[model samples]
Target chain A: MNDKKWIVLGLILFVGLFSFPFWFNVGKAAPAPEVVLTEQAKAAKECVMPTDFMKTEHMQLLDVWRLKVVRDGVSQFVNADGKEFDMSLSNTCLDCHSNKAEFCDRCHNYASVNPYCWDCHIDNPKGDK
Target chain B: MNKFYMSSLLAIFALALIAWVGAPALPWLFGIVLPYLAVAVFVVGFVRRVMGWSRSAVPFAIPTTGGQQRSLPWIKQAKFDNPSSKTGVFVRMALEILTFRSLFRNTRMKMNEGNRLSYHLEIFLWLGALAFHYAFLVTLLRHMRFFLEPVPGAIQMLEAVDGFFRLEILYDSVQFGLPGVYMSGLVLLAAAAYLFLRRLFIANMRYISLPSDYFPLLLIMGIAFTGILMRYFTKVDIAAIKQLAMGLVTFQPSIPAAISPVFYIHLFFVSVLLAYFPFSKLMHLGGIFLSPTRNMLANTREVRHVNPWNYPVKVHTYEAYENEFREKMVEAGLPVDKMPESAPEEMTEEEKE
Candidate 1:
């Protein structure tokens, strides 16, 4: 085999880089981040949309809300169930899901999504202990 | 349509349908089992292919030189193009791999009205190839977020940059704006489409293109389409997807119920790609380095390259030949190395009889 040492070295690098994630998380338990719902959220039993819709498309909804409220000056939103609510993340949505660390950060951190929403809006507007 | 690409396209469609329909029923197979098997085959097969290539001796310095080779001290040499040293070869290989330098020199020929030939520099193939490769690489790197438990900051930063050209567009009647749209996936899809089109639309390319060529392009395009479908059109549960990804890497596999069948289709295409890589022309990933014409030094004039396959052969010496033919030579009045006993000048007892 010509250039045996170099070929072996190259192969090692290739395998090491591709299998990085495996070795990085080997022997480590990666439990799915569980969101803790506040009592208010639990009692309400519903959100602006269904649980499944919110699970996949909460970000898109938030974007639509931001455009409507801040840009269009339309603070009132009408949901599918003909339910009307204020289009404010801090005042309306966060009112029920107040536990930002457990609810928002849990999944956000798990998915590594750095939403710019936190740049302006407070994590917890209610400041309940 | 040629039977080659038609069969290839059909095979891809069949594979996709299998995963899209079968994943829910056999989650363990699509989610856990096939991915592991595919990776194993990919790694082992890739190494074996490389080793197989290395076993065959180069036996010659056949670097494809495009510039002046190293020669006279006064003559200026194209160091990178026609490398004579290891360092030069390294730089050349780097440029070749990184930039597709050779492809950039592509030219198109057309016969004019008067039987005259005209050449035009072709750059689209090189451009398409470059875009396809880089976008694919970036997309692959960004996917690491799923496998890693605590997704690294570097990957997050890469994601931010890749999606820097953010646009707010209404896709499938839903306006998406929060995460924006990553450019790598779109670029990959577009570039793949372009490459595939090149083979289909171009007369010469279409004639020469084989099933092997179309298969990978179609497979990758299918992978991209399913991925885009999951990301934008039919949004899958990211958290559940992440959970499944983490499970695979941690060797504690699970199939989350929330995952969409589209993900399975995408995964199926990816798995097929991995398994097919070493056996297909995709081995160019490894072949580029082992290619004798690209990697060898163009210093055949200076360095003596002995063929390793040369062997010793039995030969009759001139002295043995003269000894056997000496009597015949003396009789024929031809020059002889030694006087024969029957020669007129030297008479022997045996010859006297």
Candidate 2:
């Protein structure tokens, strides 16, 4: 009985440590970030990519669009719907969705993504945050 | 015995590294498909193996007792080595699993000048094995940042603690920025090397060691080496790797182009190891818990252990034996439990009937 005391203590510790992740998570996770769409997105009739594709694979698509437009000097993108549009982010995409807070930042923050597009291309150039 | 482990290990690593270098042509297969397949196999195979072990029933109190059993109340019993109750059994099993207590008690035999063989404490194998397993666990926990979005707070704290002791305290409090140096990876590699060299160099151990014994060590070493190389030498794109790892867990796996070729080699080795783990001695990771000899209590003195398969067996009864050997027994003047019938009595039987 005396020697068995350590077993009880060890068991308590084992269960405690293994379950720490779950216990620590209790009443503690951040609530999901919300996406808010404004009139800027509502007024734009179409986007360079389809809406669903943009929703899921927008990062990869943006990566490819960045490489081609910046490096290869290919500024025009033909959508699957056979509509050609300028592939410039600052001039074409931001032209319609100028409010970064209403559009880009919402979904990006929700997904916890840090897109490098803003590193070189400023989201706001009028000395604004 | 043939010293083939090192060459085979190097060949496998070099070939895998070459394949990774050539992976750009078919990035999807090596990067996306194999990791998913390996993880799937690891989960299903591990569960199946454990379930298979559970199906067998232990019908005997066959624990390997190394100490005194529970007897007279006056005599002290070894509660752990020869456990008499479930609690003692639990403690023994916990010690065996957590600290490899049995292995820690390992001894080596050495022939003395007087031709007398003596036993010496062999702590290196135990120490190396312990260090290897513990460091591997820490490294694995530290890798959670790659697989989770934003990473969990506990994992972050663990990573910070691990980095704090990453041989950084001795370097004048200088912190290695971005991806700092990790001691766990290096310690795992060193421990594995010690285990490997011990088997390879020792004559008796080398003679007894088989290809199967060396295979897992080599495979694990290859994994650690490649992982370290990618971390310190080639310098993989950390963001791309996180994206890839997160994607796999999310069931939306995608290969990031910015990821280096070295990372692919690391992934390839890991996949091979995972797929091979179920059938290899690596299954010992799960078997330590299931072993009846380690898990069972020595309670035979306090309780009866009836064999479930016990059944009636044919044997000659004493009455039948006496009846058949009555003449021989009487001739030999041997006393029997029952008396044999006399000849005169048999002759009078006709008149009596």
Candidate 3:
């Protein structure tokens, strides 16, 4: 009842501002993307890496792939699972998952990642998916 | 300030180094969980501390009045200095918080050549303080880049403006004259060093300063130093940092492999800072707002400010006094409200109104 109201209000403000990141994300979990690979990826019926591995490590894998193709002049990749594929991100990976919005943006948008690979390595298709 | 500062300073660096070495062995713990836990502790502890203060009762409207209070309407009240209204209180608090107005008006007393005391504005301390606080704020806002994805436009604009003074020199057709050299970091470092030294160099300040006062300053400096080192000298990979930072942002934390040891050291410093914040004088950031002297309206004369906790006490009325001492009252010349049977009627009818 005294004039200590500001203290409580200020405390609330402090707590609110600090805990913003924790609550700003509450009930905002964008569902995982349903990855639909193109006919090329489906026809091969096999991927450079296992589905589980690709699910988590695709970004780094693509990063390493880009490094190998662009800098080291290495076109072949040998996954930990003993699978060999071209180290080209645009042609090798994107060729099968041509529908960028459906395949890449699915998880990326859910996770709020805007990868800049399309800035240089254009999303040009080998043909229509 | 002498050995305590050195020991605390060394302790912070030792912690940073420990975190650096421990990070490789426990990457997720250092890179992800620690930051989250530190932030959580900071938020909860800050709230608890402030709320604890709030539960205490303030019985008086004792705003530290620097100017005239609102008396007669003809007497012009000093709204900013001795505010009688809520709006005036806000303005005073704003000036105090935004500009460190009291500090700006700081004075130092010195004995003149003629043996007379003289007061002068201690402007350097104020300037250093102003520079340090502002620079720290800018640096904090600038670091929002690593945590936020797609970096908000406002932050980008702020970053550009902060780095606007960078003198661009053509190097191999790429303009790079110290890529965004934030003077804020250097200014903050200098100001902190000056403030820290002031306590040591000046006898009065050294006598007054406790280890508590010096520790937070040294700890903050440690945080700033490690941060600057990571940013400028031993450059950490920005992308890997972004991965780690963004992981925390999205609540999907994964430790990035091969992140720089310097980055871990910097992160450890920051984590320690966060954890230490609520328990330390850093809570002054929030306490300033809650200060009754700064926040309360100086209107004691105009309004009857009641004490909420004031208790009621029994009163001894004249009737009770006469009833309790009727015989004694009749024995003396003292008048009583009621007449006793043995008392004189003339004296009993006394209209003492």
Measured by DockQ, the strongest candidate is 1
Q: Give a tens-digit lDDT track for model 3, residues A27-121.
A: 44322346677787789887788765465446556765665677678889887778878888777888787888778876554433455577787
Q: Model 2 chain A — which ten-residue stretch has the worst lDDT?
A: A1-10
lDDT of model 1 at position B220: 97
Off by over 4 Å in 1: B113-116, B170-174, B312-353
In CAPRI terms, model 3 is classed as: incorrect
Error of 2 at B326 (Å): 12
- lDDT score, residue A58, model 1? 88
DockQ of 1: 0.73
Q: RMSD of each candidate?
A: 2.9, 11.2, 8.5
Using DockQ as the measure, name the better of candidate 1 and candidate 3.
1
Which model, 2 or 3, shows the larger TM-score? 3
Candidate 3 A-chain TM-score: 0.75
B247-339: candidate 3 lDDT, tens digit per residue: 786787777677777778778878888898999988888788778878888888778777777779789987887888876776876786766
How far residue B134's Cα lies from its native spot in candidate 1, in Å, is 0.2
Please state the interface RMSD for every predicted structure, separated by commas: 1.5, 11.0, 8.3
Please provide, for model 1 over B239-317, each residue's C-alpha lDDT reduced to its tens digit, 9 standing for 90 to 100.
9999998999998998888688899999889999999999999999988887788888889899888766566768899
Ranking, lDDT, top scorer first:
1, 3, 2
What DockQ does candidate 3 have relative to the true complex?
0.12
User: TM-score of every model?
Assistant: 0.93, 0.66, 0.72
lDDT of 2 at B321: 92
> Which pairs clash inside model 3?
none
TM-score of chain A of each: 0.95, 0.70, 0.75
